[model samples]
Target: MSSSGTGGSDYDVVISGASLAGSAAAILLARQGARVALLERRSDPEAYKVLCTHSLTACASPVLAELGLIPALEKAGAVRNEGRWYTRWGWIEPWAGPAGAELPYGYNIRRSTLDPLIRARAAQTPGVDLLLGHRVTGLVREAGRAHGVRAQTAEGEREIRARLVVGADGKDSEVAKLAALPVRRHDNGRFGYLAHFRNLPLRDGISHAWFLEPDMAYAFPNDDGVTVVAVLPDKKRLPAFKEDLEGSFSAFLRALPEAPDIDSAERITKITGTVDYPLLSRKPTAPGLALIGDAALTADPLWGVGCGWALQSASWLARAVGPAATGQGDLDASLTAYARTHRRRLRGHQYLAVDYAASRPFNPVERLVFSAAARDASVARHMHLFASRLIGPSRFLSPAALAKAAVVNLKHRRAAAR
Candidate 1:
């Protein structure tokens, strides 16, 4: 979009970080007539985040649809992941629902493709000015309220003013840091390892998750016949992976039930991920500032919620602040609404994810429901709603859901005795 109406470098919204959340916030805000300045540290337009879960969940499907990415994703051969879960009890595979009903399928495309595509969309948007290689150096604030940012650019440093400033800069957020936003950090007790495979077929483009108590493994289909295999074993199992990452990773996958033939598949990407990815959270908003994506809430990768949360949170921020951003409403009230929405939808999910990140085994309730889900279709479906982040713990533990699990377990016991 031309800068005719949008005040040159200044805008209604100045969003730091140009990854998933930043690009999404820029796009959504711009769509609502809010002028946006999307700043990125990297000059190369194609730069993408290297370490990522790369699996968007059903919770993000609506936001993706709103972003008009479904068509582009499909055209890029993004895999529609509708999959099964594995527990010690057995597999929890939910049955397909009514014909023609909208399926809760999530995309599993690599960041290499998804990142640039979305960033380009943001750049081409009507009111967003995406600044490449603009490293945010500081926040312009008065009396504890953010107003704009000073950024280091190619020619020199520049100050970009805005009504709303967003920190979407991932786990290590410079905007949050410059603002001195206190973060609540939790220790994640396991290391994550992920790599992509070429020519590895995942039938029906279905993803697979094995919840092996404290350890986890996944084989998720991505675009172009590529499958991403990941393992998040307890730190106790680190020595083996450290010594031989490929061997250890492959051995773990090969041992799974109905395991993929990674032996025959060509390894495309190097095995990479972080061992020190601690869970992080902060107040998502202040006077004129807001944090989106990992900057707002960094959860354990074991849950595969990163991509979905990034997309969903960006949508939330945009909706919460769009009107105010364009001077039609109050900005602080918008921030408060976004904060409430963030806490309501994600607090419970993050609590569970961070708790599990400590390398703990399943509690009694988890074990009971997982075993029942393995045996009963209805139980499995209920579990899927929870595991996929489609429903929170409260709904997952509702009397109706627990009744199904209880009944399934009782029947299984009787059948075993017989």
Candidate 2:
């Protein structure tokens, strides 16, 4: 890796936390001929985030294809996943394959394999200097604008200066804290637990989820014949889960309406869980600094949108500020543009995500729409697009669509009565 002395403004961009978002931004910026310093806290190249669902939604396929990583991921045994959502009414399964002519199916892969793949790609990109074992201690601010970072490494402290500093760090980001950006948080009332299991029957590349009001569970078929099973129960049920983790998880799955036979499957990993997952939304940009991925916005884990949003946000920032990093545009204007774009594209989605994080039963509108989707193929297609992140809340819950759903339900009720 190229070495820049402490406090030297040598690189165009310095990105902290080189996992998915940081690595992606580094690769894109470097490819655009901007010198980049990608700093990772962990020295081990194989290190991965252990507490993730690792499901990449269909919305990310285009971004992955553009980055030239999809083919490699598929070769490494990533599984394509079609979604099947089970509501209280019935199951809503969209047609498998491309949703339209362009979008490919979603994917499920273990993070143990995914993190290394992205990190290696970033390290190999031209003009990118990968600095492993470097943890950012603080931001370097001059005249109220961030220009670099003070990081600690095995060899002691060093300052890496750049024209732009990006915080692609996770939820508890030191960069965001040091920058003192405004933040908004929504309470999450659900706790999540997950484990990898072998010997579980595959659903032909389909992922399944049961939305049993105030509780939810999912099974995702991942690489190498392993399925990831997760349960998100209300906090009120925490005592039972804490008493017997494995038993409680199994019973929870078995108790679902059309339960999967997980009791016959052998778990390959120890169960892991988290209870303090509040939804966070941070301002995306400051003077010479920007935030992406979970550092900028983190919603509920139950939606499984984190991984895809990380890549998407990285792509957005790279596109928005690539020319500015290369000295062709106004940096401040570019940063403001990125912030506006991020908010415009994601605010609606975040609202719904945080609302669901409360683990409340479906509202009247949700019940009407979901039930109609289950009984009608046309409604199911529209609903699938929204659930897969291809469409926003406004488009999904449009007046025309809601009216059609109501009509479909009325017809279904008449048919049932006969």
Poorly placed runs, candidate 1 (over 4 Å) = 1-9, 96-103, 203-205
Candidate 2 lowest-lDDT run of ten:
1-10
What TM-score, computed on C-alpha atoms, does each candidate reach? Answer: 0.95, 0.95
**What lDDT would each prediction earn against the true structure?**
0.86, 0.87
- Per lDDT, the best of the predicted structures is 2
Q: After best superposition, candidate 1 residue 316: deviation in angstroms? A: 1.0
**lDDT against true structure, model 2:** 0.87
Where does candidate 2 stray beyond 4 Å? 1-8, 96-104
Which candidate gets the maximum TM-score versus the true structure? 2
